[model samples]
Target: MTTLRIILGDQLSTTISSLHDIDKHNDLILMCEVNEEAQYVKHHKKKIAFIFSAMRHFAEGLKKKKYNLLYTKLTDKENTGSFKGEVKKTIRQHHINHIIITHPGEHRVLEDIQSWETDLNVSLEIREDNRFICSTDEFTKWVKNRKQPRMEHFYRHMRKQKTVLMDDDKPIGGKWNYDTDNRKPPKSNLTIPKPCSQKPDQITKEVISLVNEKFKDHLGELDGFDLAITRDQALKALENFLSKRMPSFGDYQDAMLEGEPWMYHSHISTYLNAGLLLPMECVKAAEDAYLNGSAPMNAAEGFIRQILGWREYIRGIYWLKMPGYADMNFFNATRPLPSFYWTAKTDMNCLKQSISETKKNAYAHHIQRLMILGNFALLTGIDPKQVSEWFLIVYTDAYEWVELPNVYGMALFADGGYLASKPYAAGGSYINKMSNYCKNCEYNVKKKTGADACPFNYLYWNFLAKNKKKLEKNHRLAMMYSTYERMDEKTKKQIKNDSLQFLENLT
Candidate 1:
């Protein structure tokens, strides 16, 4: 009756039901650091350090609870650097007859495990990942016959089903979304909330050294990295957000400021993505803050939607259409990502700031991701797969399942109208409206066709022109084209020429 349990880095949940009834004497738990995961993309140094440190911390916690454990450090010399290789070696050494695992976050990893079952003569059983509020089956049931799986509709249903922010089974404040109230532009005198940070412990310091030695060529800085790795530390991060930050989260969640890394952001995504903090716990914490009159309803509801609505909905969409989902490219874009994306050396002030911050901290708020980097990629027609891979690697909060849908589907609109009704293509005005980065830009945000014209303006029109045949059928996109039709031919030709010049320089 010998068994082995495999725990992936992202599946470090202590409450996972897979570990419920432990025959610890007969069963061994296996955890490994695989290069296949890191090499999938050139991940930021901070991201690599974070996952490794968190995994090591979780392993230590499990040992303190007296579980039979087999953990691999990144520096383990004999490691084969692949999950299957490590698992096979463990099975032979331990004489394990069966292996149990929680379902992986990505389908590729799941398929890899499935491919090995017949050869090993061992049963590989995968339990559900219960950290999510809704199960895959539940989401599938909700989308059974729907022609389109729009997230807002699904979000409303989730609200009703879970009774989150409900009054007598009806939505509180009589509205399904308070998004309109959450989009205020940043003002000159706004008071910014201080971000939460956990001081590095001995284990995290070792992980930093491991990353420095092993991944010296990676993209980001390792010197300024510090994140919560333990449950108590994670709880404190949650508390600080509730008490100090959540009240202003809605006011400026969409607004970007200069020299500010965290303006009313929770900074809890790292913990939540790492399994150190559960999403439901965060949702409840926000709800309690609203109920106690410690935070405004707009801020509470907005923060809750990001978790219970957006985070949950994206996970469902990712699982529903994957394996082939990564290849979706509606625009047929073949361009490589601009070199400035990696270097952060551009005259466009917004992009420069966002990318420099990404290089510094290996983190950016959701708006920065969607609007700055993702927007530029979408408008410029960069390869969807490359853009998606960049997103998967750059951030500490990224895992394939969460990162893919947001990057490919929501941000890039590469899913060809599956996750969104239309591409979120926009002219420079949208960026100007959202942030102060445009104020200091060399290119004028108002102009579209001259040398001093903003790149977003020309590229946006060019994007629409290039993809009109594909997008014309979408009702939401039809009006934009109709407006383009009214523009003089002279102006249209100038936009095309400017766009071509910009594309030429992109490479």
Candidate 2:
């Protein structure tokens, strides 16, 4: 007469309300590690290690609280390599009549869970996932009667609703967003305080060894995998960020320095994404720092936007237009992902820094992913599927629900401007203005129409010119494309030739 409650690895919040009403005497918790998730995208070795280790820890914690737990290890002999198979076997063995689960993050997994209802006699009850600040129902309600869905408007609404960065029904500092102040370039000879690093203990090291042996050919290295695997450790990482890093996190969040990987970034995305830490707690910590005058308003506001604004917004977009969202390709791009992407051997200093850091740590800050590597892929028309696959495999915090909208819509503009207002397409000048990579590059950032010229120069203009018919109707891009049409034919041809040759070498 036991009811089984299934908890996915990402749903590890100790304070989950779904567990509140559970009768521990008659209910049991089931957590499993299936091969389908691990092999889906060749996940980073550290990412796999992080999840397995965290799940093991969570299961142990639940056991101490006198809760009946059925934990399935990945290397278990009975493992069927799929969630459906595992659930079916468990149901038969336990003779469970009712199955309760919190909502899954990905649309595919949600559908798979739904399929189980008719196949078994068990009543499947799904509780809403309340980890995010904005509920799916609330977001849908906000957009139920809207024509154009802009993130800015949505972000403002969130700010007011959450009472974050607001002052008595008005935005603080007379501005709702401090993003303009947050985009300053890195200062010369800046003394960046070294961030804290965690050393793997026995449990974490064992998980790392398993990942190395099992996922040997994955995208990232396992040597430097020092992420938090328990809630206590996650709190330490969060405290270290607010005290040592958050003060400068806003000023240089977008700035990329040579050979400096952690430049004022919190580096806590791995912990938050893995469910070891909750978003509300993280947001509260930032707010506390600001109220105490330990961190500036700009810094606190910027960090909150990343969490409550972009993070929540992307999740909403994924659920709103999914099931067929992964196949979007507005550009019809056919180019292979550049070979240099796999190896950090590019002449472009920006790409080199971004790629090399990602290879070592399996992470890069938001700007590095969006501006350098992502911008290059979008401008060159590399297949969005290929780019999205790379993103899914290479990051420590990559879950399809989060990675898809960010890469396919925001990065590649493959969804025809659904998640973004317009393409974040830009030439090398933007990179040069924002970073010091341009100073150390072999190609000339200023040159526009030759082999010696920076590829971004031609590719940026060519992307606009080639996709003009597709993008001309966008009001934000009208003036930009109008100028392209009036340009002399000879100039346009030379730019196109340069872009073509660079793309040829890129593949």
- Measured by TM-score, the strongest candidate is 1
lDDT at 393 for candidate 2?
84
What lDDT is reached at residue 451 by model 1?
94
Pairs of colliding residues, candidate 2:
none
What overall lDDT goes with each candidate model?
A: 0.87, 0.87
Off by over 4 Å in 2: 482-487
Evaluate model 2: give its lDDT. 0.87
lDDT of 1 at 257: 86
User: Each candidate's root-mean-square deviation in Å?
Assistant: 1.3, 1.5
Error of 2 at 439 (Å): 2.4
